[model samples]
Target: MLIFLSLYFLNDIFAFSGSQDLCGYCFDTLVNSFDKRNSILSPSFKNEQHPIFVTWKKKGQLRGCIGTFSPLPLHSGLQEYALISAKRDDRFRPISVSEVPDLDVTVSIMHSFEQASRWDDWKVGVHGIRVSLNDGTSIYSATYLPEVMSELGWNQEQAIESCLQKGGYRGKLNDRIKAQVQVTRYQTSISKMDYQEYIQWRKAKLTSIRGDL
Candidate 1:
């Protein structure tokens, strides 16, 4: 039988309250390139999603931002990739020890990819995005916008332009061969910076609430 089913991720609608492990897991995933999404996901808490976008900010300015598109890669889901993206997106390097004290993190739980051929497909403050061409040879990613580019002093055009430039489109932006743009959306659990004692607290909480780890 051709069995089929519809699946959904409910991490965004209801998040784990009280304990800050999800925030910590997302932060750990952003800070360290270690795959710990599963171990970090608390079954008792009931949210089982990984690789959410982790954006770092200080005051009202952007510090660093990064995450994975798909749930990392099974054993090593978004946990490792997100951290790598934040620290090594090339736009900015990993947060340094000096800058650590003045940063915050936002974890955006991502959705699947969607292609936009019509201009109507675009929207502000919604839709995380990926533009690709040459059969996936070229690609550019942006998860949760307005914030990402706005922080970089970019308008909508500038953001898409940057993507186009980085996307390696041999022709101009208005080239006859239109782009194969893939858009993905995510829900973020943004928390204020809680560096001091956050990790230690998480370690204790995870073990206490859910002994699986």
Candidate 2:
């Protein structure tokens, strides 16, 4: 399970209203990092281990996206990857503190991984596919999140072919190469929040805490 970054913007058709708290926690972590603070306001959710991804967008464009397939403790994992994806995704420059106010954050929790029967076995919009290709001496691998297919309007075969190319496969896309591809399919529960929403959520949370106190 390797960490990969995607530049694709999530399709508008899919709605991710799962966990604002999760996205809030990610935003908190990033804001703290930018401010040189070590303290994080505890998240309002239970800590559990899950394979997670953190994605950042600026004005609906991809800023950074990265995550791992390994299950990790939610609190620490979110905190870690929140910064990693925002600042370390090599495809784009590191996100600055100034960018924080304009960014949107998304958190994806991946699960139900199954080995596909064939390269084209996975569903287009339902499953995120990871492809591994071995071209005799070298091995290449990459993954696209579930929304990618629908956003790009690709059928199963096209999605697989795109994934092969994404995995750094430079060889021909003949049947032999396609036949040798190993695919693993997984699904994700996603949550998203924009910077303004984060501020509002934080304000409401603080007000609630104060009232309780």
Candidate 3:
């Protein structure tokens, strides 16, 4: 019975929709994003837009992270963000196809972006913060995803300061600095998979198909 339950859970991992696991679209994008290809595996996602961030990590360090606040169709958004995050993130060098085998992909589907009453209004682990401030000349903004604070063991002030620094602010962080900022708190539903997991799922799927023949 234990073996059967374990297999049952493994079967669920390979199943795509509503499972919070990487879907076929993610694997397809991982391949096509570097090839400059434009084909999509399934167009079943809604035509409406959903704000998304694609993150790539190699050996548990950040390789790339880029996305948009503007909502776009999930099909195109996933593909576009995947490539952009992998290759175009200005903070790091481009990811090569050779790095694919060691990579982990995380898709963050963002929602409920609400203007926070203050910088400290949101909870650390629950909210992803997007902060913008005009320091006399131009507006600067940066965002950190929900898991960032919890993962880094950052308090609310530390998280906000880090985000401010990310936005290109080199000025002193103080109550005055905090007062001018417009903070929007959001949430994300994330799905992730590593390359080895993807390969395993592919093998399992193929084996299942062959067994049925």
Candidate 4:
């Protein structure tokens, strides 16, 4: 299991329709990082804060995935995490520039958090879950994004148990442990862009800029 910490706070819900432009910004950030140049594109969205996750895939397989539970300004946060997920995810080696063309990026903006009555109280596909367990010695925490449960075909119990293991809990699983778990459920609006699509978007943006000039 990949190890990543998860934490959140209750806040007023904000409207965000995950946009292709957001994913384009991520791609631009990453390519610039690889080239050791500053990003040439600015995010067009408002600079509102939200809990965001950036996930990278290569040829339909998980290459890297990382994000923050804390709210962060959209522009800087996406810029920061685009590189972090690609270059800093410890589950895999740093993504090389050569691999950029084969990669697809997904940006998930998380919102609508609610405390679950029980570990299984939330809908599987609709909610991303964060689970925390205190076993009288230490607290273990982990999260799965909203798309994860449906993608993996996991029931609520299975997802919770898997999240526990991902959080580095080696203890026995029983009613006692399940009863002790604290669960927070949330949702995300996501946008995905493949490398080719990113390239096309970049070209169109440049064309539009030249036309205006």
Candidate 3 lDDT: 0.75
Quote the positional error of residue 143 for candidate 1 in Å.
5.9
Question: Which stretches of model 3 miss by more than 4 angstroms?
Answer: 1-24, 33-40, 43-47, 203-213
Flag clash pairs in model 2: none
- Against the correct fold, how does model 3 do in TM-score? 0.81
- What would the per-residue lDDT of candidate 4 be over residues 137-165, giving only the tens digit for each residue? 98999999989889999998889999999
Off by over 4 Å in 1: 1-7, 10-20, 26-47, 58-63, 73-82, 117-120, 135-146, 149-156, 175-213
lDDT of 3 by residue, 1-213 (tens): 211322223332223224323344566677776675634445444544567788889999999989887766777777788888988999899998899888888877777567788889899899999989899998889999998789899999999999999998888779998899888887777778888887776666667768978
Cα lDDT tens digits for candidate 1, 1-213: 001100344433244323355456555554443333424533233435444555666555666666654443322444554455557767776666565445555555544334555422555455444554443555543334434654576654455656656655555545333434443333333334455545565667666767643
lDDT per residue (tens digit) for residues 1-213 in model 2: 322211121221023338798899899998988675534677877666677899999998899999988777788999999999999999999999898889999898876677888887889889999899988898999998997688789998888888888878777767887789999988788898999999998888888988999
Best by TM-score: 4
Error of 4 at 41 (Å): 0.8
Whole-model lDDT values for every prediction: 0.48, 0.82, 0.75, 0.85
The local lDDT score (0 to 100) that residue 48 gets in candidate 4 is 74
Return the TM-score for each candidate structure. 0.59, 0.88, 0.81, 0.91
Looking at model 3, the pairs that clash are 49-72
- Which residue pairs in model 4 clash with each other? none
lDDT score for residue 194 of model 4: 99
